[model samples]
Structure formats: C-alpha cells, structure tokens
Target: MDNLAAEQATDWRIDWQAPWLAALRELGQQAHGLVQAGATVASGLQYVKQAHGLLPGWQFVDQQQLPVGQAYEAFICNQRCIPTRNNLHDFFNGLIWLHWPNLKQQLNALQAGEIESQGVGAQRGRLRDSITVLDENGGLLLAPQALCDALREKRWQDLFVHQRELWAQAQFLPIGHALLEKLVQPRKAITAHVICVPMVQAPAMCTVEAADAWLSEQLRSASCNLVNKPYLPIPVLGIPGWCLQNQNFSFYDDSLVFRASRTA
Candidate 1:
C-alpha cells in the first residue's frame, strides 16, 4: 500500500481500545499472578504492553545516543495526543479521571505515585503527519529552508512568536503523501508536501472541530501535503498549560478525559 494508506491503517487497532480493556485486565491478572507465582515475567510484560500498552520499564538507546524508554501501549484521544504506560492496572485505573477531579490533577497524582506506574513511559513527538497547501501566488511554498535559516540565525524567537500567533488563528488540513525523494531538492518540486503540527489546545470535545479546521487551512497555505488522517497526537509532557487549553490531549486510556473548551 502507499504511505498515506499505511499511516491510516496503522491506527486500525485504535477502535479496539474499548473492548480490549476487559480482556487486558484478565491477561494482566493472569500474568501478574504468574509472575507473583515465581515466573520471570519478561514475556508477560511484553504481552501486556502489546495488548494493553503497558511496557516493562526499560531503556534503549538510539543511533543519536539518546535513551528511549518503552511504553506499554498507546491510544489516540483526539488528533494530537497519546500517553504510554508500562502497567495494565495503572493504565486502566487512570480512567477514573474522566469522572472527578481533572486530567491534569490525575496526571500529577500518577506522577506522585497516587496512581500506579504500570511500567509505561510517556513518549510524545511533534509534527504528527504531512499535508500540502497552496500559497497566495498559487506556487507551492516548498522551502522549509526559510524556517531552517531562521532557526540557524537565532531568529527562532521571532519565528516562534509569529508561528504561535498564526497557530492561534489557523487550523491545519491533511493532504495525501508524496514520495520521500519528493521531500528533498529538485524532485521535491515534482509534487507538493504538507507537514503540520496540531494547534495545541485543551482536552475538550468542543475544540476538536476548530483545531482540525485551523490545522487544515494552515497546511494548505504552506503547499504541503496533508496526510488526511487524524493528526498525529503529540504527548503533553511538560507542555505549557496554555497550549493544552484548546488542543486535544490523551495519554494512556485512563487519562483520555476531556478538558475545558476554548472559544475561537
């Protein structure tokens, strides 16, 4: 299948989040029972992470020499959030935040050990998927070199300010994907590309549509190819409270509760 189709298909299992919870509880119970019964529990933890998104609480180093920890499982609450965990019970128990207290408080509680770890690591990334947009002149604005140049020049302070303002007003749209070679020089002109990060917002249902629209328009203006699927959810670790006020957020299923919505 093509890249666009591939990315969309990757989320096929997301819908299973609802029903799989019960079965996962059983599996975790059995595995913990087995581990408590003297089994090493290596494979069992992997099983739990796979079935439930709970990881074994370990680490792996990438080529960049950065250490990446394992998360048990991941779920998309909206277009731009996924929280991973290492334990099944802790992951499920987080659902309690949906009713009382608030997600932020729950997360704080989880961090403070008021909630269990479930062996999951919170891994979040930016720039969820790609999109293509058209500039006012109808020319594809293919040069991210401008952004790169701005960064190298230490003009990021200005750029960030501008981007932050634009993001406040614009929503991104998804376009189809192009080949990797299309992302580079010479051949990049062959087809347009759209890359986008969601307009960060709070964890509420009302903001969902607005966030989606702003992202779409911004991506289209940039002449990039929008991926057309749900925006890739970024993890909300250490993100400023203001950013979360309007964008969708989710981490581990239990933490998928909605936040207060913002007005346009």
Candidate 2:
C-alpha cells in the first residue's frame, strides 16, 4: 500500500471512542493526530514528549538505533531512549509511556536489573517473565471486594449478569501494549492478566493519575514478586458495556470464552 493508504488503514484500526480506551481517550486522540499527519513513530514520540511533557531524559528513537547485541531493556536503561518501531505495538507502547511513565519505568528497571545480575540467559527467570507479561498483556482491575471475588473464582454469570450494576463502580485499565493492539480488533476470548485492586467503595471517583500512582507504588513495593502470576483471567470484552453484544444476558453462556475455573 502507498504511504498515505497504509497510514489511513492503520488509523482506522483504532477506535478512539472504544470503552477500553476510556482512560486513554485524550492521549489516543492526540496520538491519532500524529498518525493522521503521517508522522513516523520516532517523530510521533517527539511530538508527544513535547506536548505531554514526558520524562525528561527519555526519548523514542528508531528501532535501528538499537545495537545488534544489546538487550532491549538494557538499551533503554543505559541510553534512556526506547527503540520504537512503526507499528501498532510500538504505538500503543508509546501511549503507555505517556500515560504511565512511573509504571513503565518500574518495569524497565526490574528487567534491566535482572539482565545485569543474571545476564540474558536462555530463560528470562520468573520476575522478568512476569514483568514481560505485565508490559505486554497486563491490566489493572479496580473493583469492590465482591466483584474481585467473583472474577478470581471465574464466576462469569455473577460478575457480568447477576451483579452487573457493580461494574458502574469499577474500572479495568488495560496496561499491556500488546493487549491494546489486540483490542483494536476485539474478540470474545481476549483476556487480560488482571491485578485486582479492591476498593472500599466504587472507584468511580478515581482519576487516571491516581490509578497510575497507586499501581506504580505496588510494583515498587517489596511484594512485587509476580512469579506465580497473581492475576485473574478476565475476558475483557465481556465486561458490561464494553461490547454491544455483551449487553444480552446470554452473552456469558459461551463456555468457550468464559471457561470454568480449573480445579486442583
């Protein structure tokens, strides 16, 4: 495809108004402008950096700027710049950096520390693997105690239908860049490794900045060992009001998508 055609094609893939993008709506709109203007990923990063006033030292450079042998995380830590590509994956990644700089920085630090101490071995080790999962396909679920319990137990009917009203007081922020890319063409089985953050009351009053702060703090704490993957499997599209088809009570009946929990 021609350059303009390819850009337009990519632009259409992103529904800026999608419910999953609610938290990122403003940044998404600004980034869409860069896409519409035909700015390359590297240049787009510069625009967002200046417009949004991102981290002082960090910048986005072309993927080619990455050396042949250096690890990606190592490069980011040593050089303070991200090796970005011209694709949706990198695009969403940049948006994540814009929205959650602290969380991204924390993950990068953990990864780099692992590489520094362990070297890039055949296996990424538990903490590094967990960090990768969070960076690529993680989510933050803010909900009441009951809602969190329903999700942990895989109680689809109770989570989505029986206690549907509870969703109004809850929020699910998609943190993984790969997850955001996949959501561009949403599917029934698109699940998120959700870290449940139980709230005393509804999180309706919470702000994006507040959420970012809280999540960053959690990752920085000593208990950040994610080896066991302390995340719940939540089929994101099934969240009430996220997908039009899910409005029907029977939407959760598909065992294929909402599988029952495995027993010991």
Candidate 3:
C-alpha cells in the first residue's frame, strides 16, 4: 500500500482529556468525533466548513486534487481549497483551520506571495522557510513582559518554576498542526517555537476569539521579522499544570532538553 493509504489504515486516536491538549480540547473533540464516525480528513473538514461557516471560502480537498508541479500554498491561494491527506497531520491541520482561519489565511497568502516573486526554487529562501516553521511548529504565548522576557532569555527555571503562578495569568496556544500531532504521544523533548504576544493584561481574561484576533494582527505586523526566526524555543511540557513530570523542581535539570542560553 502507498504511504497515504497506510497512514489511513493506522488507528489514530486523540485523547482530548490529555493535559497537553487542554487548550485545543473543544476543537479536538469535535474533529475526533467526526473521525471516529469514519470520515476522511477532507470530508470531516467539509463538515466543519458547513457547520462553522469557515471564512475565505476555504475547503479541504483530497491531496490528489493538487495538480502536479503546483505548490501547495499557491494552489490553496488560487483554488481556495486545502489539499488534505487522510492522516493525523491533515486532521490536525483541518482543526487548526477551523479555530484560526484568519491566521491560516495570512500564512497562506505570505507563502503564495513568496512563491509568486521567486518561482518554486530548490531553496525556499528565508521568508518561506520561516513561514513553514511557524505553520508546522509554532506556539502563541500571551503573557506579561516579565514572563515573556524570562522565556526569551532561556530562563527555564524562572519561567516554569519560579513564576509558576504567573502562568495562570498567561495563555499559550499551540498554533502548529505538526506540534499538535506530536503531542498525541506526549514526549519530554517536545518543544514549540513560541511567538510571544505583547499583552500586559492577564491573558486568561481574553476569550479564544479575542486571542485569535490579537494573534492574527501580531503576525501580520511582524511578517518581515519572521525571517530572523524571532521565536523562543519552549519546552511545552515544562509549563506548570501541563505535565505530571514537571511538578517536581528537578524536571528542569535536564540540560539536553532545556539548554541554557548561548553566550554572545
């Protein structure tokens, strides 16, 4: 069997109750229910499009629908359909599109614009590479300046332990579909390239829709700086309340996963 078919045959399960998946539980459960009913990724996404009334007229189409020699982003931009495979990767991608349509649209536009300026070259160039990284493994970190500073500086102990209570005031949303897929089988080394959102007020007060809107604006304003990969590597499990292993103070002692900041 081909890779896609093999992947479809695999029994895929998502524990929505998992602490790591708490942030995405609502949407995850919806998608999980559809998949459990034996819906393919494209079909499930089509259902979501109808139910949620997804904007920009984006629809999920089979990967085969994507023409040969056509870039995925460019195709989505021109055709208004996302090429999806029947796998966990595309399943989570569909869920993200439902939750953050504006962000997904913006990312696609940036990618398509890049491809237009510079044809599908062997090298994707800096902007395209950065955009891909964000789409695949990014996180949105809405926290106070202090917590953000601690994280950006690689002060794991300060950010995850000392300021543990502060986490209640913050919100960290996993924006990358690949990151969500990886968390299905929780691992200690699972990290996210967290983009810090500038918000002094407690993020817990902001609704999911409000947070999504704020994040979309932030990304739009900083599209250029993305080329520099201005993101902090965060060991997601270390976040307080996300994992049982991290409850102990010694969890941050692993230098391999939570490495110290490099010298200038």
Candidate 4:
C-alpha cells in the first residue's frame, strides 16, 4: 500500500477513527503506511531487527522500528508483524501474506505498475480490479461449524430466526475488514470464503483441510454453491446491517439476509 504521504507527518491527520477496524486500530496508521501526524512509516527494513521470515523474502519488522513516513516500496516489504492474538487486522493480513505471498506480491506489483502506466485516473485495469475484488469481497468468515452448516444448508429459519441461541455461536474471525464489512452489509456477487471454526465435539473438529474441501465441493457445482443455489439468496446482499449499520441482533427484526422471503 503506497502511502502517498508526501507532506510532513505532522501536516496530515490519517483516519484512525474506524472502530470496527479493530486490528488496524491496534497497529495504528503508521504500521500500514498511512503515516499519521506523529508517526513516520518505515523507510529501510533492518533484517536483524525483524522476526522470523513470514513470507519467503519478507519479514516482520517491529512497528516501532519503522519511521512514520518513509518512501519505501518493494515487492518484499516490511510490516509491523504482531501475533494474531495481539490484533485481528495484523493477524489476517499476516495470514494472507503467508498463505499467498506470490499473489500478494503480484497484486502489489500490478497496483504499482498501474500507477506508473495509468497514473491516477477514473478507471483501473484487470490487476487493480482483481486486487479490489480480493480487498473487498476476498474475505473469509470463520464461524462455528454448526453456524456454517446452517448457512451452507440454507437453514434460514433454524440459523437466524428460530435458533436465537445459535446466533451467539457465530464468530467472524478477522479475515479482512472489507469481508467483515461485506458481512455487515451484503451486496450482489459478493462472495467470501467460509472457514468453519468448530465449536463442538472433538471428532467433528474443523481443520484447514475440511474447510478447503468444503470450498472445493461448493465450487464444483453451482448447485452446491450457497451464493449460486441459495435456498434464500438475500445472503448476496449481506448478513444484515452491513451497509446501513453495524451487525445488530435487533436488525434481525427487519433483516433482509434472513428475512424469510419465501413461504418455507
């Protein structure tokens, strides 16, 4: 993320006000290269000062080491890599970086290439489009397995309506703010990877393999894809209160996501 912070750190006030952006809040603007008034972004990454390499060539630099507003942009970049338990935002980003370093590098490379070639403009090319797609819709919802089953099976009444207690079991692991935002307010064609974190018996525990298997299964047939063959497709819009407001159980009263639109 090229922090276009040309002005002195003291001159500009970055938006650190997003409450739901909890993880980012923990890292602060400086970590992600926003370069707020007081903090300067990292310029030179000191390998000795960093933790073990998370990506092949990239390592986690202590947020403290980075200068607030440094003009440093590279495929293998430095970041304030904290433990996931420490902060959700950093955790997910770190996980993504680890899982798909090449993709991340490619996207960043493309974004930079676009700026160099296209400059700041109204339209963007494919790489930017892919990055934006992943940035916005490219998120996963990590919930209890039972809750995931409810969603996958399209058990709207059991999941959202009749099963009041089940709602409490739902947990959204910080995949990405955009994904979370989409959950908060759904829209058409907005798809997310679902990671069913098991909150049940040991035998049926959720594993990465299981989640990947489910994803593959769903993709194999549109009939299996919840978004494609939705028993109720309002899920395409979102989990409810996503755009208009925060995720609220109260919003369920008039929720379009689980609002039994059919005569089930």
Q: Could you give candidate 2's per-residue lDDT for residues 1-264 as a string of tens digits?
A: 248645653666688889988888887777767766777776777687877777788898888899999999999999999998778888889888888888898889989999999999999999898888889999888898889999988888999999999999888888999999999999999998988878864254287677777777767885555778778889999998899999987899999999898951
- Estimate the overall C-alpha local distance difference test score of candidate 2: 0.84
Residue 104 miss distance in model 4 (angstroms) = 5.6
The estimated TM-scores of all candidates read: 0.19, 0.93, 0.91, 0.40
lDDT of 4 at 123: 70
Q: Write one digit per residue (lDDT tens) for candidate 4, span 150-223.
A: 66666655555556465455443233335544433334345454434346532332443343344334434432
* RMSD to true structure for each model, in Å: 21.3, 2.3, 2.6, 10.1
Q: How high is the lDDT of residue 54 in model 3?
A: 69
Clashing pairs in 2: none
Model 3: per-residue Cα lDDT over 163-247, one tens digit each: 8888887878888899989988889999999888657543443665666676677669984388898788998889888889899
Q: What TM-score should be assigned to candidate 1?
A: 0.19
Q: How displaced is residue 130 in candidate 4, in Å?
A: 9.5
lDDT of 1 by residue, 195-254 (tens): 323223322223323433443344436432323432222221211122333233222122
Q: After superposition, which runs of candidate 1 have C-alpha atoms over 4 Å from their true positions?
A: 1-20, 45-259
lDDT of 4 at 137: 42
